[model samples]
Target: MKRSKQWDVRGAVGFAAFFHFLYSCATGCLLPFLTLYLRHLGLTAVMTGTIMAVKHLVALAWRPLSCILARRHNKRRTVITGSLVCSAAVALTLLLFPPTGNSTENKSCNISQLNNVPTTLRPRTTLQKFSPSVRYSAEHTINPIQKHNSTEYISAVPVNISTLHNNQSTAETTTSSRSDGKNSSDVQKPSAGKRSRSLMKREQKQEKITKIQYQFLESLKVMDTQQQMFFFIMMIMILWEILAAPLTWAADDGLHEYLDFVDATERHRAVKPWKLLGAAGGIGCSGILVSVLYCLIGTVLHFYAYALLMGLAVPLAALLPLYRHKREHVPGAGVKALQLVRGDSQAMLCAITAVLTGMAGSAVSDFLLWQLQDHNATELQMGIIMAVVPLCQAAFAPLNGCLSRLLKFHGRLLPLAILGLSLQCLSYSFLQTPWTILPSQVLAGISIGALWWSLEAQSADIASPGTELAVKRVFEGLYLDLGAGLGSVAGGFVVQKFGINTLFQGTAAVLGLWCVTLAMLQWRIPRQRRINYSRLLAADASEMSESESEQDNDWLEKAMEEDKGNNNWRRLD
Candidate 1:
């Protein structure tokens, strides 16, 4: 039985990891570089933004539907189906993409461009940025990216994702502040007196810097795991705009497409392009062969045509997770414990991530499309700018060991990382046009790195000691998916209503609030009482300690008895 269970764990974990990686590559990696693709396809900024944002809405809607299907049928089979769906969507999008429209003819694209704003996002984040326990008082809700001049004092923090990208800790390298760059909150404050710690008998007082560090560390520790997860998920969605959102954001080549369409119309004017006997849908192509071709060829394009491939990636992303599932397995003990977290945490993360993805991605795409509606950017230039964040993050994340060593502890590391990202994002509140969005992508790597590190590290701390490592990995996966779903929905709506810059600042506000929440949690929720488990799961730490001591004494007594018996026999002999 144990052997079977062990095999199940190994199998489940391996398959899940495979599915997740494939899904991630298809969803995040591909989409991160999508912004430039939509521009090449004749999409206007608003149209591109809408396409990017709307797709997320579809993907978000699909996540639960997919979840349900997975539950009712074989989970692995469902994931497999999902992966195929992504492939199909990619093909369909490519085939249906309209030919150039006529300039003289009245034409409309479903998506529009929004200029005067910058930085779009993609839909694929997996969780929130902070724990739920952290709450922001109404006081810190300042929106730096707002048009109102009152809070405009907060200068935009552009992320140079290209900076130090060669470093292994992508998060550490990217989340840094510009040397002369100022955050909205960097205004000098009245100095506080020094303090002393009980741990150190020295009479030396605490420095202001030490106080901030202490407060910051405490704040980082206090955030509720749930809230942190929420913030982490949301932040990733916001960062999603770093690249792919631009695919939808660039200025529409309406006239360019119209000219091409006019030429096509002229060519076909003499004899209509008639539908062939075996034509699939409205296009003259076979469905089966076409789909397979897209899946195979699309993967190829995704690797090579960084800009053009995103249009395909948007739809394809929806399906990859499904196929990857066939490879997934659950650990022996985790299968049971995961049951406890199956719906609540998973659902919350997915829902929030989707909404945020839409919010950030839609808004930024709109802004960029508006900026580029005249089509000033060449595809290559846009692609490189969009490419920076993911490229930097991918390069840096693996070097977490080196980054961790730089920090004194995880508490310091995670929060500093979070703050650095927030500051990087906040920098965008006041930057000028054109170059505005470009710099922020660099920061995305750091923000994403910080958010991911905190959640994975903290979840490990929270999981039951008996649970296998697989449980936490699953926890990370589910939360990430949920967050991605929710972020898309939220991001889309927010972009539609508020401008893209507002969405960016709005995200910063959320991050700031998360910071406050962390502080509150640290102050109130004592370090010993981290997870507030139900009585059944909450094994009192003191009780466990006592039980362990008692067990140890029993073993000691048994050993002493044996030793004494042996000694007596030897003495008698």
Candidate 2:
């Protein structure tokens, strides 16, 4: 059922929130566990790093193309289509590479194979002299027989018998001695047998060890093949991200337009666009929660369930078209959109914010799971801890928005969020237990939630009227993606070389510097130039009132024209 165009605003918001939630779910499910998954498939750290880097590189490359397409076509349609495509790619990858067996099962199976190797040895008594023929026969019996015809063996046997007879006289004294000592030899035989049995056990153990190593090598070959397939699947996912990212931002623009429409109509006087944006954070938070739930369930149950649930975003996003609207023709919209999509002070700031956020986020993502696992945290524990971040973000986002409005500090929220991020890094650097680390994620959540809301609002505030906010969003997404991608690449090397602790410390230091830089920059900007929500609300209200009055006049004129036409038609009849 299609709703009226005025109700499209609500639909647009709903679709945007749902899509954002799904995107979060997909990324959260895959990215947090990606390193572990690659390692399981026997990919070296370097290979893993390369794969991660390539994914971002592909996504970064696609941003420009996606941006152009979003600008030239239907943003909402593009978003919906991209969502479906990315979802399919995720599902295909999951199907191609089924979840690996548990570590314990692989270990136990290898051990059992080694344990089945049998002992292969016999006891030997006294150092009694042997004729050459007897020695050769004994040696031949102990060793593996060569494959040959019966005739050849028979001929050799005759020669061996002749030689034995020739040496028979020489062996006579030795034989007599052996017969005389037989009684004593029998007395000591049991002891010799005991020693030989111990030796045989040792040999069996060694043989088992060798077999295990061989099995391990064979397993390595399988792992390599699995890794290659995994790489291919990940590549497809990255390519999909490249196409999907800009489409997502385009949806952001559509929501912006819808908000503007609501304001002009004065349908919901109490609700503001920024508040709605903040509330939308819940959608993304739900995604994070869902991914975390999958992680927990995967640990306890079958992993296939997790893979399926992670991809639920696709079907949820397919409904975006129901909320879509035709592009409203605004004067100079194209040129303004292009300008905002390009470079400007606001864009640069967004890029800086995104890069710094990415760098910090990369370091955290690389190490958090590892740290938890190292501390012997169970999968369920880790999942809960991981979910805390998004949960906090979800809870705090609306609060931050309200705070921004109440305090009239539009730009200050970012600095506070940065500080929260810095605290998270510091806590990770020092915290010993994985459980203790959970509290620190609240800071991260706050940082992330506030940063997102503030950046989006700030970006919109700076753009000119009639400019599609999606263009600015595209640039924002590009820089954010670039920053995060590059951060992950560097983080891999850092974690490999210096250890996880150092990665956290380094991230904290870097974020600290960024916070300082941001503070200084904000200080230099005059108070009058800073964005005030109060002033913005006043401006929007005046503009909307003027537009509404003009619209009312036009409606009255159109009604009069229709009535006049009806009267003329009746008179003619």
Candidate 3:
């Protein structure tokens, strides 16, 4: 049955924010406690690294299995099941293996370490206190990711500063009570206990990370049929390195800058956890409140709240299209019009589309980034600029879910994407005022949001079929991951050699090419192409009665022989 556009976008914008919130929390949420977790588990650094690396390695395989499961069931069920699995993993991290040791490695003691970081607790400014400086501070660069000059790139979970600080302070008090012992000098501190605890926490956290890696792999596999998975992965590939490197590096520099600036005002900052505890037996809110006062100066820190909110929103928004499609079925003959067609060749076409589209998008984005920053940046500044990619992603990423309803290629959408990229290029090519770059950053955000979702949706349709979804999803992962790994590495090289403008131009050119390829594919396989594709399906329809007989045939045996040669290449297998 020709399904009508069963558009039931139920849920307010707030609902969309909720899911993206969880995902954002998942990113940095674990980090603050990871070392503490490692201490509890008592693992060595080598062991910890192995656990983490192994998780990524395992992720490489698990995605395919999840995709198979999804196909066997369906997209909705697969997502639900995968979500439950993710939740289970999180529970295991927090509750399943509560630190066994009651000594230095215990969870209670780790909480003590946190309590000592006074700056985090009792933040001086009111939550939601947005001042005018947040709008026009020199410290604030032009938001390269927001679609508008005013929309800053503040994506990430809202760090509950008070929650974070209080937790740490509480842990610090517990640790101090142990270290200080009521008599003040009653017993020698056991140094070995501290080392063991840190190591243990590190190991366990790493193990948990490894497991999450596998989960990501499987989700990628399971989501293959949906096509949006490719777009998601593409963003990861194109921006992970750019974002991770700069943010991580710039964070170090930015902290140093903050301390220096604070010093001029006779303001004190919180010490690293161990140092603070050594200086003071334990930090309480009363004591921490003083430190929060110092931070009242750098109020820009709180924009992270908005980032957190946006992250939570985007993923939850996705459930709308899926549920709505299920509900608004036309009466009577609608089911017959939605017949599925399946073929190995069509599956292969789907995979190719993901790779080509990803390549085009990734190349353009990275090139533009490099071109914009090449001229007057230190390596540190370059890293800071690179942070722009993820910051933008955090703000604009939610737009993808919003796009599910409009599948048809809109002429305006592509131009918007192009304009965004071109503005970024011009920012590199011309915009000298650092502040002017903010407008360009906003444009960049829009481009990323539009291109990613549109390409993913289109790719999913490359070879639509009702059967063999497992095999289809496997292809989805192969093309997507391969493109991402290649793209990130290449993007790094391009930035190193060609000046940033050349890189931007190259990326823009690739975007243009990507559109052309998609246009050609669309023209060649016009909707009537469905009727042509249906011929194989229609001819094979009678065989549906003897599905077993067809599977037992000669080609199945031939395909099995080829499977041994190259895994990603299903045709050869």
Candidate 4:
């Protein structure tokens, strides 16, 4: 039986690792480039931002409701499979909306022209000046005799120099004879009429050229068709997020449920390493694939790759073990969690920090690609850059244990993490080349990892008995949903109004100031008054175990009274 249980644990772990890998592969293929793809479709910055913002907002609102429905209906596996299939189908539909008009061509032209405007304008003006004479000679110099085929027209031609001189003398004699009478007006009329005709032709040709140039320039702007397409694409994205967002929460719940059933809850931490590895592999590999496809076809194949991976994961999602155990529903769990957070000043600070961190992280993730594209970074470079972040996170994850010990001793991890985030933001503002930004990603990975770790530790510390999960859920909502949603919208507006550089610089300044405030707040607390929840919880657990083994009823009552007194002391502290 022990061997059988061991085998079951191994199988569950292997299945989970593979499934997470496939799911992450699908997500990594599309999400990093989703904004870039929108911009490629000729949507303005503001429009792209709005679409992204709405996507996140819709996901945030729908995730909880979807999870609740799935749980209530006992359809966890069904929801997971259905959402993946639907998401894959909807993502594949993006291929149907090809870029309209010569927008891509015009955008490229605009960029080149903007760069060399001073040098290019001189040649264009010179060509315009010389075009009319060349056009007139080429188009209008046909022989009159050839068209008329008449003896009179043939006789007017000067076949030799002597005939040309004789014709000129005859014209001069006629002009002399008519110089004193109304016949003089007849002689000048033909010359004036010919000049007016030539001028009219040149003007017409110039108008045509000008109209063509105007049309070419206008193509760089978003057209009505593109606007309609944007709206349609935005709707599809929102729908995609609505369907796909719940998968993460549901998968987590399912994994925990399975672990509980197996009596191997300690293996929960063991699963994260696999998740990180899978995510890093997926992101890195997909990026390279995208670059290759782009080089071969001159178009992004993000959605196609996403669809293929998602389809592969759909079956695995169905196969996932999601065991349900009968348990009594706890009422007012949310209210109790809220009260716990409200009573703890440290928890409130941690919650605020989570919001800020989410905002900064979201802003960077959404717009960093925009900045890189502006620098003309290739798909491969972007892929490597993105892949490095998760890789770094995984590499540095072990250091978190050491950092936790140091933080427990020094209590400065959260503030330092905030400072690191500020520096990362500042670094982005000064980015000159895509490659130069690589090192900053290490800082980013570390800062974000530490910040989240500290927040989770703080949450665990502050949570009251029986309300641990609820408190953690509240923090997750703050960090991932509410904070992320607000960040996307705010970042979009900032980028639209002030440009990407300003957005980065301003965020850095704000975060730096916030870091200082947090440091000052931390310094104000007296050391002796601080509670060590980890030690307290450890001691409480040991005491409870000892009490359970005791046979004396009076000793049990005395222990209960002492526990109550300690709880009151904790509240006061």
Candidate 5:
């Protein structure tokens, strides 16, 4: 029996780790390239920003609701598996709508003619309207003439002019003869109108042909396709996010519950590092795979890779050893979570810190690729930079556990993590080359890891039994969804207006100020005034006992009498 139980534990941990690894593999494959794919589809920076912002905003509202429903129905495993399967299905659907336009043709044309156009003519609307036709006529009229000598070209021009004159005279003579009974003025008017109409028709035909050729040459067809599909894509992405938003939270919560059931709660930290390691491996490997496939096939296969990995993870998610607790519906769970946040100063501070950190992180993640591209970084270089972050995170995952323990005693890690984030943002502002940004990612991994660890620890300290999931939902909604949504929208506008550099600098300044304020508040607040779940739980327990309830009633009456005598209860802090 003991051997079988041990085997069950090993299997549970192995399956959990494998599931997380696969899930991270899918996420890493998809997210890093999603914006790039949108750009490839010919979306503008602002449009991409809006789509990303909407995705986060939807997650903010949906994550908590999904968690609540899952818990209430005791379907945590079902939710995880369903979300993974649905998200993978959606990801695979993307392959059906490949981006339009031929990049090679556009490059060839742009190099031959468009690049030779003067900068002054580039921005003129009229030039844009007429340049294609002019180029088409120039190519056709000049190419054949160039094949002959200069004498033949010069002689050919006069012959063409003489023939045009002869045709015009014949047409006039025919018109005059036909209208001999009519007045000369009336005959000339009809002839002139006919000539103008014919010329207009010819010009219209030429213009249509030129426009089509230009669109084909410049690959603007891609933009047209994107415009037509933009709304559909947005809806698909929103649905994907709605399904994906609660997955990590649900998995973590279920894992903890399982650990509690198995009397192995102490191993929670050890188990968590596996997820990080999986994430690191997934991100690094996916980056390499994408770069290799892009080079060899000149096509993106990441979406396919994402779908395969996520599909594989679904079965593992179903097999996870989640311990579902039997409980009646508790409608006040959210209310209690809110009350805990309000009562605990540390919890309130943690929430604010989460928001600020999320905002800064989103701004950097969403726009840094654009900056790198502007500096002419290649796909491989960008992949390397992205892979470095997760690798560093995985490398430092054990250190994070140790730091969480040391900082839990004094509750100093959150503020320090915020400070580290500020420094990272500041470093981003000064980036001169793509490779120059690599060092900053070390700071990024460490700070973000520490920030999340401290926030989780603090939340655990404040949450009572039965309110854990609700409390986690509140914090994650604030951090991942609300803060990130706002940051994406604002970052888009800022990058469009002042540029990405300014956006980074401004975010850094705001984070630095917030970090200082948090540190100061923590230092100034008295320990006695700070609230924790232990005090609240003790008071509730005492209230439930008859003797203690009577004693509390007597003490309350005495307090009321004192308040009546001195009005101390009404005094404002």
Candidate 6:
């Protein structure tokens, strides 16, 4: 029986890590480059922000359904279906809308040229400078070679007009002979008026064509392309949300539930939440690192093959969860929606923290990309610079976890995470060169790793028995989504107005203030009053006698056997 429990634990954690890695890999490949891609397509910063914000805005409506699906059906099946759908939608989007250098400008200009200008009305100022012989030859007696090369007429007419001007006395003699007693000035005046009128008409035509081109370029930069691209992106984002939300929600709830179960089975606290969360973070970091490499190589080479390969990674990683082993199921699903009204201080804190984290994290990509462009970093250097955050995260997360285990302190790490967040913002704000990006990324890794592990475990511990754990998880997810959306839009405006460095400075200031406030509040709260998983799960921690324990184990096994055949999901009241 103990062996069976151990196997379940190993399988669950391993599968969870695999799922996170694949999800992150697919997401990393596309999302980090999404804003840059849209800009490349000629969308302005404001438009890009609005479009990116929509990606997260969908989560507001979608997150609740994720909880419902996870609770009301087989989570494994739900995860698989979601993974497949998300994979297909994302793959189609990238493949169909592959990037082309200068395609946007070329397309816009082509349309303008077709609609706004006439082919025959070439701007002809140079013709007035031609001498009589050359001008006559150019206009009336074209050589076969000159006819073959139409461009020669332009240069020939200009030089001949200049020569004709130099021989003005001969031109006057010729004109006087033709005039035959009529005043030459009188004959030439009307012709001069006609020439002036013709030049004026030509100039007006040229100005009109220039005006049309300018308007087309402006429209391409600011408005309509963004609208078209927004709708296109929304189609993909909606499909992605429909699938990814449920699977991710289920995984989050499952991991937390598994932790509770582990606590119930072990007499002593053997599996810590920090270690579990850190491992997940580590896997995510590795996935992002690989994703950045692929994105850089593909983008620089201007090929979709590398990105498509990354998109294909989604389902491959998803298959791990479908391994035909007995999955650990946590019993009881009730009205967790009711707990939303309970207004627990701890839950509120967790939700607020998630929002801040989302705000800080979501816009970091845009800022980093902006910095790379400003500094003129190469594609490979940009990829490595972008990858620094995840690498640092992977290194520090488990280190923090191991430290937590050794120090026997979990709540204490929350402040450290906040500190890391503050430092990251400062680093991004001040650092100008590629070399400086690494230090900031190290801070980011620590901040993100610590916050995710500690905040989640803390949120779960505060929930009462009647609460739906899935709902609790979804609440955090929703806040994060909201924050990210708002941040992306706001960051776009900030970058447009004050530049990327200012955005980083403002972010740092906001986070530093938050860190100080969180530290002060944390200082006031007693350690025992705060969350501890062991204490929280210890309600079912009572020891049974040897014979009773055997009977309980036998009953649990029989119940599991019965449940194997009846896999109906429970609904919350």
Best by lDDT: 4
In model 4, pairs of residues that clash are none
Per-model TM-score, in order, reads 0.42, 0.59, 0.34, 0.70, 0.67, 0.58
RMSD of each: 31.3, 18.3, 24.9, 18.6, 15.9, 16.8
- Evaluated against the true structure, the overall lDDT of model 2 is 0.57
lDDT-better candidate, 1 vs 3: 1
lDDT of 4: 0.71
Clashes of 6: 8
Q: Ranking under lDDT, best-scoring first? A: 4, 5, 2, 6, 1, 3
lDDT of candidate 6 over 310-393, digit per residue (tens): 455555544443322145343344335335523565455556767886887777765567576567555445555565566655
Give the best candidate by TM-score. 4
Query: What is the C-alpha lDDT profile of model 4 across 1-573, one tens digit per residue?
Result: 455534377677778877877787778878878877766655566677778778877876788778777877888999899888999888877766644322222122334544554642211101112222221212223243223322111111112333344566568756866674766565687886896688567656765665665564345334344565677888898888988999977877777667877777556555565666666676677777766544233334677777888888887987786766677545576679878887777777778887887788788888999899888787778888887777776776677678766665334788888899899999999999999998899898888777767776776777775566568877877777777777777888899899999989988998999899988877785432347677785674446665565655678889999999999999999
Candidates' lDDT values, in order? Answer: 0.40, 0.57, 0.38, 0.71, 0.69, 0.56
lDDT, residue 528, candidate 1: 34
lDDT of 2 by residue, 1-573 (tens): 997644566656556565655555545545566565554433444556666667667766675566556655655564556555654455445433433222311111233443453322111111123345433222222111212211112111112333344366447746865786857555677876796688567556765665665554444343333354555666666765665556554544445555665563222222333333333333334334433443222221222333454356556655652323355556555456546645455445655777788767865775577677667655456556776776776566457547765866566777787888888888887867777986787677777877877766665665665553545544454445667677777777887788778888888888888888888887775543554677775664456777787887899999999999999999999
Candidate 5 residues lying further than 4 Å off, grouped into runs, are: 1-7, 96-227, 327-331, 404-410, 528-573
Q: By descending TM-score, how would the candidates be arranged?
A: 4, 5, 2, 6, 1, 3
* Backbone clash pairs in model 3 (N, Cα, C under 3 Å; residues 3+ apart or in different chains), count: 52
